[model samples]
Target: MTQEQWTAVDRYFTDLLVPPDPALDAALQTSAAAGLPPHNVSPNQGKLLLLLAQIQRARTILEIGTLGGYSTIWLARALPSDGRLITLEADPKHAEVARANIAGLSDIVDLRLGQALSTLPQIAAEGNSPFDLIFIDADKPNNPHYLAWALKLSRRGSLIIADNVVRNGAVIDQSSSDPSVLGVRRFNELLASEPRVSATAIQTVGSKGYDGFAIAIVTTDQ
Candidate 1:
């Protein structure tokens, strides 16, 4: 699709799917000021997160990346009054911006600044309380590692949403040797064949690009 067409579609989907929220608007402003890469989840994707959280009546949600809290705010907003969300970010500066954006919502959200690879293990060691919903949007090259970690922390009915799986469709081109694309391709293959979960890859166009993502739901049998 042309860029304009893509933008139109995104706007249509988001408008029909989710209404504007003050917190999300503020978070977007913070993200812009931080000069961080536009890593925040898309509005339509955020709506999807909200829907998934509600579907599972998720009490504990985990997100591996917090980009100025734009996406974190979306996910946290969906939680029940008593529900909690733990988000990890490696950049202290980014975390600071995210914290500021997410101010006044500490009762339901915890923003941890550190390498997710390290923090995830620590969190797992502390308890066996599995997450009902896990969103992975960290470094693309670590997609495989993150998936492995996410599965361990996932409950039988949990959902694991991995963003940027398509890498702008570069994943299908074997000649494309970008580490991020290669990593995503491998991760997709692994998940597609794994017996533990069922997944579907959906193409989407938005600020990210003509890219797509994978949403995997862990089966009860596994």
Candidate 2:
């Protein structure tokens, strides 16, 4: 009924299903201590990402945001020893904090510091194998751009997930001047017409309040 209730139910389910980890708690603590916006996904959502990666048997992952590395830790743990996860962050302060949070995973975690707009192209230039899973959770205005890059960097069957798509139902306000809301609107429209992937969005409510994520599977190379 209330956001509080939603959050409580989420935490209850998480405590019952997910094992507690001190490192994850430490990541959030360090992020807050560093005065970073607690924009990271909730613990249940992070675990969902990990589960998706595991189900996909993802050997390569590309994450467009790395705020404090909270989700990064979860996703990284889903990878095999030889797998790699590259996360992009624009804020140097956030990246530094994330580096500390995920220090033990340095071998498999590649935290890239810079605007994803620029760094994504660099990743393309390097011409690595297609990513098995791609997660986009960065600046809202660039979501469509991130999705475009996700398509470019993916092969058939690759999973692409975008966070904060519902934006508390603000996505329906076509005239809203809020850049983030407008950006998600544009993205929804784009996804509706994009034929390269079969996509859908799922609305969710939890400790982070109401939001949603878009999950798509690359259906074709086109």
* Per-residue C-alpha lDDT of model 1 across residues 1-222, encoded as one tens digit per residue: 688887888888778877788888888887897798887888888887888788888889999999898878878878889889999999998999999988978999988889999999998998844999999988888899899988989879899998888877788998887999988988898898888999998887885677887999999633
Query: In candidate 1, which residue ranges exceed 4 Å CA deviation?
Result: 220-222
What C-alpha lDDT values do all the predictions have? Answer: 0.86, 0.93
In terms of TM-score, how similar is model 2 to the real structure?
0.98
User: Candidate 2: misplaced stretches above 4 Å?
Assistant: none
Extract clashing residue pairs from model 1.
none
Cand. 2 Cα-lDDT: 0.93
121-193 per-residue lDDT for model 2 (tens digits)? 9998988649999999999988988888998999999999999999998988888999999888888888889
Write down the lDDT that model 1 would get.
0.86
Per-prediction TM-score: 0.94, 0.98
Q: Of the candidates shown, which would achieve the greatest lDDT relative to the real structure?
A: 2
What are the root-mean-square deviations of the candidates from the true structure over C-alphas? 1.5, 0.8
